[model samples]
Target chain A: MTNSIRAEWTKFRTVRGWVIGLLTAIPLTVLIGLLGPLGSSFDCAGPNGAQCRGNTPPIGPDGTPVFDTFYFVHRTLTGDGSVTARVGALRDAEPWAKAGLLLKEGTTSGSRYAAVLLTGGHGVRMQYDFTEDIAGPSPDEDRQWLRLTREGTTLTGETSSDGRRWSTVGTVRLDFGERVELGMFVSSPQHLETSNTFGGRLDRGAPTVATTSFDQVRTTGAAAEDWRGTAVGIDPAREHEVGFTDDGGDLTITGTGDIAPIPASAGSLGKTAENALVGAFAGLVAVLVVAALFATSEYRRGIIRTSFTANPRRGQLLAAKAVVVGGLSFVVGAVSSALALPLVERAELAEGFFQHPTTWLTELRLVLGTGLLFAVAAVLAVALGMFLRRGALTVTAVVVGVVLPYLLAVASVLPTGPAEVLVTVTPAAAFAIQQSVEEYPQVAASYTPADGYFPLSPTGGLVVLCGYAAVAVVLAAIATRRRDA
Target chain B: MSALHAEWTKAWTVPGTAWLLAGVVTLTPLLGVLAASSMAEGGDPARTSLLGVTLGQAAVVGLAVATVSGEYGTGMIRTTLTAVPRRLAVLRAKAFLVCMLTVAGGTAAVGASVAAGDALLPEGLSIAQGPVLRAAVGSVLYLALVGLLGVGVAALVRDAATAVGLVLGLLFLTPIVASLVSDPDWRERLLEWSPMTAGLAVQATVDLGSQPIGPWQGLGVLAAWASAALLAGAAALRLRDAS
Candidate 1:
């Protein structure tokens, strides 16, 4: 058995095609992973790791800043209340630039807040926290009256095209405090530069300022009767950059600001860690082709006779081949994933994207788990080859089983429920092994399968893939034992 | 007519032909049922139910490739040539037989897929009407063209692996590679022209307005691809020495 295992290893190493495939799978995996984030060209100066370790508002778990920065005017509200403002047109606004009435927990970026705001170009939008963007009616009126009413933690947004009849936009339940900042605010992101090329924004955008005025500002809720306005996010060094005047019934505010670490979903892992596994599909395809050919090529060349004649025992041959292919794939997958993840994380950080750094253990699991996924997938591919005895068919089976489902599930084309079901059943379920981000119950998000979630835990998903592989191997063993070479 | 009849018998007589054809019929609806069963409300039932065509095409390609390449593999091509005398007629007969078989099997598979989808879909999905009918019939045509593509590519490449690789790669990889295009216009063009993307468009009935190409137009693109491959294959057979 040892001799046959040694012979199998020797036979595998001897194949130039297999060696080239393994060698390419590594760099291809890392490169593909890097390419996704690189394509986005993430640019931000939001969170410094050490500064965010404390998870200060605006700063996320790994010190990446959540979008929490905005000027505020307030009187501590004890109970249910409302703030109404007739918002004047914003000047030099961005598409996502916002100015409207808001009820916020505090001055921090990630704190719970919901606002009915007039956007620069896309019309009215209702946004809560940092993730949810609910579209409201696009009334023809340029100036609109917006109201945000709070009842417990639930905030309802209303917009009036003519300040006479208010129409409900939407309401979101948020976690908040009794002493909340409720008032009107204005913000504009950096000036965006459009590329002549077709891909995403290639240049880091320049910052721009926007000023918006509010007329007939009034409060009816418990905290709104008496109001004091203060600019919370104004850096002392950058004094006079952003300000608000709340004199009597009217106010004007201006600033070049946005909640930091803007809203971009890179799986649940965010941009920082999704890079770790982005190349996984690219690498897996190469591995599938090589692993499948490892079995089928012998049949194609009619060397199955020679292989069995030398080994005599079909089970030993299968076992030895499995070990050799599995070990080789593991090594290739691990090294490539290791090289890709760190390089991508660094590049994202340099590009101004803010992120909480994954722990060493999380990183280790990411790299090693990818290795295991490919290893098992390769073994499965080999088994499929034994069953089908066709290079194209077996590779297609494994790819359809793994890669295609992963793509479809993540395409955002399928709705949440079906996408989740897809990930649960297919070998692509193994992808859950690489998930490092935990979904918080309090956070409002899509939380769909397309958003980097598996219905089963990572280990559980991997177990699903393992189940298919075990079946294939058992069938291969039975056929090899019973059939002629 | 006699040559066509002879080719018909030749294709099914090959090992695994019947099972491969059966696999296409069984797996198509089985996968379609699985997809349809898992769908949420408001989904285009026609598209979701016919999703199995993506997998079904694999078997269709295999059947067509085996029809041509299996003879070459067994040195039966020499005997086939001796029997027919005219090589082009033999290739034509083979293509016709494979296409007819694909159309027959594809119709069954697609009909089963729709029936399964209609039975399994949670919402009101009418399989008996409108774009659904076009989708079902067009899917059958799509498979036939893909089968012809397999036949054409196999004749050109000769080796089973090489031919299967070429056909499947053209079918699957073009869309993937095209997706990397940053410019939306070019991406749309790439998708519109890609054989697999355009061919599969026939299965899309729900959001016809949003599809890159119209159903018939997309199928036309796939047909154009098949015609080109067949033309190239014919040229190869006429120009190259027969083993």
Candidate 2:
């Protein structure tokens, strides 16, 4: 077995053109990754006629980009306190407008918090830590009572139609000190409108402000000082858009911006990590040519008969070939992807675009998953070469099967539904390995594959492509045994 | 003239040529049906119907590459070159034959695709319509130019698999990579420069202004790619020794 493997490796390295073809994948990936960012630039007018950089959304407790701007009217609370508010009317509300009572550690953005809120469309919801959401029962006639209580480190959110009776909306544990900011708050996310046209998706978003009138506001274990109103994460340019008016006990707070995780598709100025990996397709094509020719050229020259004479076991020879091809491709993919990510990010940064925050674990997964994707695709190409015993047909079949489906699904005139289905069913699903941004159910965004939100998780997508490669290898092995080489 | 006759005979004699042409015809409409049926509300039915051309172009590539590279594989090119002695004429003959067959297959395939669209999609697609007719004829021309491009690349690269891979990358990958650009002007420039994206722009019937490139102009860009590839192939044929 080792002999056959060594022979296969020797044969691959000996061919000048094939070696050059495989190596070309690395530079092609790096070059395209670097050049794609050069063409894209972003600029916005800042305060006092200065140029504004891209959005720098706060990083949440889970280390994801989050919108943390809202209006807060608060008083300091000691240990084990609760805030209750009657949401009388929410004016000029978007569907995701929030008029709620919140308990937070401080007035800082990205701080740990919990809230029970009345949403413009969803009635009542309890959201905590930017990423968690729980729906409560429907409100009657836009009127609801929201309450948040702190018991030790545990936070409980409850909602009621009347101020007297309350049902638990959600319970979550957030570690905080004895003193915290308990408040009445209002927030509305940017209104995003997406319309599908002939070729692509069109997205337009505008800042929205929602005003909530809160009466009968009460807090337990609270300080006696007057309630302070502040707008967290408000841009100075848009400061006038957020404010609170208090007339005796009735408080009206109007706020712009959201308090949820940034959706991968909208309401953020950052590009996903996969935007730098667009060169993968170019690299994959180069590796595919070499992988196909590695097997088919031997048949073209009638060298397979000589190979079989030495081995006498065709399956081992096929395995050896697969190992060599898969290993080379994996190395090329991993190295190129790892090198391209930072370089492309730097170039995009120079052009005023920021990368959405992702954990070190997800970044590692992307690098290794991309390597596995390329390895499997190359193995599939070699298997296809053995199965068909034709060079042009093998390369064409794999490219059309793999790359064409991806281009049609993500870049062409296909609609989102069909495009998602195309990626899910076809080998092109492997590209999902590069999806660095995740879909958040709490955020309303165009979560389509074209926007880098794949239907399948990263590992699930790699498994689908591996299934194709495995089946092809089995068929190729059977054909090799049955046919006279 | 004898080179043309000899090339014609050689083309008909190969069994794979017939199957490849059949693939061009059948696969085009088959995928066209899938694309047309998958479309949602408010799209150009004419363009969606012609989406099958994207798949059919693969078959066109196969036929054209096989026509050039198969001879090299079998060592038959040396024999033909000795007989004809004029290598350029032989290449011209091969190019002519490839284009002729691709047009025939492309026309039938595109007609079936449009007919299937008329049945599967909403109204506003017919052979009598001006833009639809232009799209239909332009698709046939597009397939022919793809064939010429394939023959040229195959002649230059000489290896069948490498040539197919190169041509397919040029046809499919450019538009995909182009779509990744976030700059509107850059994206438009990239689209205008891509052979498949520019040429396929002729399919649009509903919104002409929104298109990256105009119909005839897009086809002309593809024609430029084809001619340049042919010129390179001619240079390679003139410079290199026949194996």
Instruction: Candidate 1: list runs displaced more than 4 Å.
Output: A21-65, A69-279, A335-364, A390-392, B1-6, B71-93, B120-128, B152-190, B224-243
- DockQ of every candidate structure: 0.06, 0.59
Error of 1 at A448 (Å): 2.1
Candidate 2 whole-model C-alpha lDDT, 0 to 1: 0.87
For each prediction in turn, the share of the native Cα contacts (below 8 Å between chains A and B) that it retains comes to 0.07, 0.70
Error of 2 at A394 (Å): 0.6
Model 2 / residue A457 / CA error / Å: 2.3
Q: Could you give candidate 1's per-residue lDDT for residues B1-243 as a string of tens digits?
A: 778988888866666688779978998898788777776556567878888887888888888888887777667888888888887898899899888888889989999998888788876457678788988999999999999999999889765554665576567655554444333555577779989888878777665776779899999999999999999888897788767
Q: How high is the CA lDDT of each candidate model?
A: 0.74, 0.87
Candidate 1 per-residue lDDT, tens place, A302-358, comes to 899999998888999888888889888998888988898888777655544445556
User: What number of backbone clashes does candidate 2 have, counting pairs of residues 3 or more apart or in separate chains?
Assistant: 0
| Per-residue lDDT of model 2, residues B92-191, tens digit only | 9999999999999999999999999999886646889899999999999999999999999999998888889989999998888777777777889999
Worst 10-residue lDDT window for candidate 2 chain B reads B35-44
